[model samples]
Target chain A: MELTRRDAAAALAALGAGGAVGYAAHEWGSGGDDSPDAPDDGLATDEEVRDALVAVAEVVYPSAVSGIAAFVESFLAGRLEREDHGRGVRETVGELDELASEWYDGPVAELDPEDRDRLLREVGADVADENPEGTTAERVRYYVVNELLLALYASPRGGELVGIENPQGHPGGTDTYQRGTP
Target chain B: MSGPATNRARNRAVDRTPVDGADVCVIGAGPAGGLVAARLADAGYDVVVLDAGPRFDPGDRQERMERAIRPAYDRPDVWGVGGERDAHAATGEWFYPLNHARVKGVGGSTLHWQGMVMRLHEADFNSRSERGVGVDWPIDYADLRPYYAEAERELGVAGADDNPFGPPREEPYPMPAFPPSYSDSLFAAACEELGISMHSVGNARNSETYDGRSECVGYGTCQPVCPSGAKYDATVHVERAEQAGATVIDRAPVQYLEHSADAVRAAEYATPDGETHRQEAEAFVVACGGVETPRLLLLSESEEYPGGLANASGLVGKFFMDHLFAGTGGVLDEPTRQNHVGFITSESHQFYDEADAEVGPFKLEFFNYAGPSPVELALTGDDWGDALLERLNAEYGDHVAVGALVEQLPREDSYVALDPERTDHLDSPVPDVHWNVGDRALETIERANQVQEQILDELGAEVTWQAGPDSTGPAYHHMGTTRMGNDPEESVVDPQCRTHDLDNCWIAGSSVFPTGGAMNPTLTIAALALRVAEDIERSL
Candidate 1:
């Protein structure tokens, strides 16, 4: 239960073993970016991304199951080739990993549950100050975490999945009634 | 019976005969040709107006169908160019190409425009006055204001009295302001917190049924074509002229404006079926938008007026203007999303009037709303890898977007000329546009960004990454090509919208606007058309 920098680092280092636990490390560490059509070399893979998403979602919303991870993985996979778009997420994930090593001395997925929650709480303010200069990743990471929670807990589908009352009101479909380029 | 009845009968007999004839004939339509044709027809002359654009009818199916099927490039929808390279024009709507300029069939480009009318601020009229930047407008805003009011009632705009920015006017708007949408309230609340004032944009759309048109339905699709008759386009004016016994021909494109010694004698148009028609008139008017109007004049060079008719100043195809737009979006702590449908609900004009306090200000207006769908939002991303998409969907709702329209100073450098190489499907030379932002233009944008950031913070919204520091795109408010001016040396058209070199020819649309103020350009375009309409009436 005592999560520390050494524990997270050891867990991340053992990811290449190709087992259930190793799958998380493989997914988070080497996002499957190897493709002839791949626009970039550092993109994440479905399996590896799924593993990491599941790990993050558990800490973000502990009660959810395999759903959020699948959603995030599929969504990310679909945007691999869109220029001016994919860079934000890539930068954010890369920055997240870097911050994990700085704060916890290890991979983010290896942190204990209590420490993981603490990291999430502090990230809101900390990520805002990261600046990222020429990249959009840090901003993407900050945005994505807040959005995932809002969607998972506040959306209609999310409402049916879990019991968090979406206080934002009018789940979906209504706001989209006549929206077009104005 | 002996005096009045006999005179009427004689007038009718004369009308029965072809009153006037010209070499090149323009058909009846909207603002594009209507304004020009009317002026020519009134000049003790013979100009034929063959307009076939959809006539405004309250809930008329034939009108709707006509607007829907009119091809902009005059091609079938299935033949449209597709893919990411042309995604901005993904679906060519019924009447015209999405943004190709013109409503196709008739009244030209003004058929479905929301008449949010305001002249370019004085600085806009004279970019060179204070900034010493950009070319001076052939005409100033003060000169255009009288005409702006004349055009206001002609098009019937809805606005409040005494505008917060710029010069004072004699008459108030015909109708009150259009109601603010739910999004407007939210944005207003945020603006208030940031000490910025938001105003209801003056729209040419009828707030409550005026000038024989029905009230507005706030239909989201105001561009391309409006299903509601609330919008005052050129078609209405064309219809009025036709009702007064003007003959309108449809499906004909004027190819040339034949001029002789500073007088346009005729306009030549090619019919859709490939027939050349010649009608002779005493005078001619060129109401085509900035690009096409000048193009026709240039294309019609004869032995008489070389280097294009009415090109004595050599300024016909110069000074093209389109307001630059950049979008900013972020998430708010409170849920203020409502009435997501409607055109612009509110505008931040607080910065508009005070734009050029020191070196002379330029116009900048702030507009925003919720966000587009996931498919559309994908276009806003900077990264293209797999991880990017996932993050996008995950972060969709945590944001609201603000679009800032920055007015550019009129410069000869930013012009729309015939491209040396690029041609349209019709083998005609496509317009090659070169628009660049100067140091002052960039300064206006930076100031807009600062205002946006302050407003976002006041709205209790969390900031996201800003999209525009260097990137700028056309907001589709094209203006200033055949500009009106005091001196004929620098302008193609005179203050009354008459060609400086051509005594009988007149021009309309944003082409006459010297500077592009931050407000939408359509209203001013409509106003100018109306002012020219009054001038045409007087000369007769």
Candidate 2:
């Protein structure tokens, strides 16, 4: 039948029980959050991406129960390796981490939730202004955030958490679905 | 000298059946062919659609991309016969030669299309009355409005209920337009500030489920193929036709139409394995797109009609048209580019209907996406490495772009003929497309650009760069090769899409577009196909 969050979680659990997962299939923007380039254990296992993810995810989505940082980190790192000629979404992620580090001496996870929220707003503005002399920071941030939004709104688990419907009959419909100010 | 068997003797025949034997034979399977096959089959006709290419799947995107990059875009790959010139071949990501005219298996080129579905403005029909140029259409906007509505429903367009400048319609759109992407939002805000009214673009992309399909995933991969069935493609219609009873013969390249007494009797084709086959029918419909339709007519020349059947007007492949597009981008004060993912969610047609004495009124479609790929972005800007990347990170959020797609009024001089030296598979002549924009076209573009520059300035975007020469590339909206007219002397097909002088022969697709408007062509193509199908059913 149609794939759901429970099925994906069960798949994730099975993979966890079996040790590391392999890059068998990827439903990054939908049903499954499996990374095409990940080691397959679970999510965001890349060190550089983990650090960046910890910084930004903690700021934007700090429910802790949501596990937003780990999920986003895994998604970003996976997409970075495969997209845009392997340079990665490094600049945008790096900007987030550097900002978080500047604001808090310790890891972003150690920051108080209030400060984390404030840091997210601050970093959002910073990344949005990244560069203009060449490609422009606004363009870079747009690309990165757009990818991130896709990961959040398009993935199965993300869809469940956000109350979005299953994209049955066509999995690519999420791209065309009109979203409110979420 | 050459009766049916004698003509058969000239080339080793595949199906040696004489004239008037088969049920239905469809020539070419692009948008029109695909849709016709599906509809006729659904209506209980034993339709046999002949296409030149093989079918494709979305998973084959990489292979498709490789082919596109290595050969298709830069050379004479897809045009069939000699096909059109390679000047406008470099459309990024959506480039594929074999599938250009009539994609092989199912969806046709809708598999690889950007789902823009705009209805032609009212002025599109009566060009002479409005623009003081081009011939007025045999049909008017009112005549086509019902078909437009039907086509929109069938195609599942996502557009606003209000279309102030468009033709009056029966009902509102089935679903609302797609929301504004961040880039679109920025442009909207900027345009609003500039007193330019922006509306969400009417896209063929499904906003909500209508038929048995799902919505779009906003993958930005509108070209090549939509693995997801969110976008409307002709294959979907073709598939529907197959389920109903149409027999699609993939890889059957139609060579020419076989006719007698001005009635199409059969279609000659080369199978994938090189066997020549002829499928005879009581009636023949040629839906081989603009370039191929004309090529087929030219190749099917008989002594009775030396200049080509229905080409007594000498206009079988005359008056080709394409929307010429130019893009200009600048940095706005707001964080516009950071959210490039949904860029192009909205547009402003304010400039489209405004009165202008010299060039007439032209249309403008503002882009909602971040400008270019990283490599392209790098080339556009003078920076590299972390610094360059850093700049991309910052400025992507502040960029707003406006792209203009202007209608190049039809001129008979702009035409597609077979190139003598260039031969393609099946030994067909290459389509020698010779199109040079007239003075009015240039003036139209300049006026649009001037307005866009003003809008960007008003939005406080420091205009950085514009993409185009004094002129721009003829856009992907290819149209009007074998246009329809009231008189047989001036056109290849009649208003019913039946070939003039050839009673049982018919044609379809944008090739039948009498006048190319500034709007995207898919909606119009769909409407025309629907209209032609009705006529065919009536004829039956």
Candidate 3:
């Protein structure tokens, strides 16, 4: 119930961000090339970013959820292609890793599930207001948490999980509309 | 000092080579211009249509639809409506978003319009006699009755004879009506409880493939873009005109009309290649919509008629009018299945012709796309997994909304004139729209909101938003700039839609509307364009 309250507050923050940005629907991770991980300019390598996100997803996602690593990896490929968004995402991941090293004596990917969740809470991401150009916790909520949620809800598979058989942009034909939900 | 004669001399000094001389020259390639061109071409006349915008590829609709669906993409950018070329000045009480409301391409604003079509009631024609407010149209509903039927058939309207308040029609709609959306059915129960009547809305979109286009597959982004070709746009008529031997020159914006005291000799226009050319014709038709039609007339000042081309009465850009939208939305306790349909399937015209009502008429619309989209619900949530699912289910389908188009009376204060300060890409003065919601319109909006609130209350919904008098905005139904009248001293155009001052120039489209009713103007526009085409044929 407490998580639900926090989630509602976070949802409003994410909505604000979503309103400011335009999103397009396409095959996840289909367009971008999969080059080998090459970290540059103090940003995290793609592999390190994927590892850390998967660890975060393990704690953030529900216990029934499966394929957390694969989903995060695929979604990241597409997100990393957009220049400004990709740089912000990389910086957020790098900040998370720094916080992880300082708190848990290692990288975020190497932390236990409970420890990773605790690390997120410790950084005040769960309570801080989400802002793209604010504090580290706000940036984490803006670039990291909202990005994951957007990818999940925008996808057809994730949409079905939330009773959205056919999302707004998808063409589900006239029959789906003519018949009411049973 | 520079005068009309000096401007004419300066224009003549430029390379004004004549091109595409025809029997009739249509200035715009919008619904009115396209319809006129098609009819004149079919009647075996050499017609040439000059459009200010590029001809959009039908195949690129899917990409445009993507732009509309994506939250990050701007709506204006999706239709290519920006840059110096489309700039205009809005020095009104409220900022009039002209560029967002109009598209300048081959199909014009129809390219992005929600395809609702309705006929003006008999009372709408005789507003002066019936309502004691706005002036009566020179021509009545009886005169346009046959043309309305023809326009419906030409535009391929899908509807049912269910609206009791509608004017009498001789023929059924071209196609059967679209079934009511799930949300409309929900509203029906609440409306029935309150003793209000609901009827199917007539749409230009196909119900079951009427004119070579496919039936509605419900892509659901019908306003800004319809990926499927089921929805009708003015491009349909433009293509029909082209097939009937009408030559259409795209990206050709007419700068000014070259004329003497009696008739227009030619239209001087600029192409994409930065060259000016003259289109000489036997008769000239300015089929641009309300705003641009008057702007064009004002821009075409000459030594013969210095005030403006057809401004001997000084009424070219006067009596401007638009319909204002009053909307009320809320969330019901149960699922309404909102956003299932892109367009409205049901509406109420019960209050449209209210007997002896002081306020102007208003038509209620039941919105099918009222709630947040799935993507919107998803992004706004803070929960990642199971908790997020609960929130999405609770919020997605319960939202409902009611909207009304309130009639606006033509006023002296609200008119379109050329802005002295702002110039468009071609260095021509841009249209300055001076508009304000009058006392009658404000009263109508309040009445409409009250009606909507009653419906929402009957539904036992939690009221979230209501657009009151101050919040009500234009429905983008521009009308009554070059209003039609019999007297030459009072109005710009005659009963035949001919400019009172110019012998050979005719005006078509909503600019000639004496009074704007609460219905969509496109069907009436098409009918009047067909009539203009017939008149031009008779004259030649």
Best by the TM-score measure: 3
Badly placed stretches (over 4 Å) of model 2 are: A1-182, B1-21, B58-105, B338-343, B355-357, B373-395
lDDT, candidate 3, B1-540, per-residue tens: 123475456545533344455999999999999999999998898988888887776755755664565443567867889889888888889678887888888999999999999999999999999999888999999999999999999898999999999999998999999888888888889999999999999999999987899898766778887767788889888999989998888778899999999899999899765899889999999988999999999999988778789999888888888999999999987777766558889999999998234699999999988878776555443465567667777778788999999998988888999999999999999999898768888898989999999999999989999988978788888899999999999899998899999889999899999889899999999999889989999999
Error of 2 at A69 (Å): 17
What TM-score does chain A reach in every model? 0.49, 0.49, 0.72
Candidate 1 lDDT at B443 equals 70
Q: For candidate 2, write residues B111-145 as lDDT tens digits.
A: 56677888888877877777677877888888889
Worst lDDT 10-window in candidate 1 chain B:
B87-96
| Candidate 1 docking class | incorrect
**Candidate 3 lDDT tens digits, A70-144:** 666655655565555666788888889989999899888999987988888888776665565789988887677
lDDT of each: 0.52, 0.59, 0.80
lDDT of 1 by residue, B1-540 (tens): 023465455534432222354422443355645654554444433446653232333333212322232211121221122222112211111111334444444655555454556655655665566655556665566766776786677778887754466467787788887655545666667777676666666677777889888776533335545555677777676666555455666545566665678677656655534555555665455665655666667677788767777888888767776666655667765443322323554665567655562322433333333553332232233332233345544644434667677776667776656655655434455554555545666677777777777777777777775646476556656678787778888887877887888765667677777667676776567666666656665664
- Model 2 per-residue lDDT at B461: 80
Q: Ranking by lDDT, best first?
A: 3, 2, 1
Q: Provide the global lDDT of candidate 2 against the true structure.
A: 0.59
- Global Cα RMSD, each model: 17.1, 11.8, 8.0
Candidate 3 chain A, poorest ten consecutive residues by summed lDDT: A11-20
Question: Local error of candidate 2 at B101, Å?
Answer: 8.9
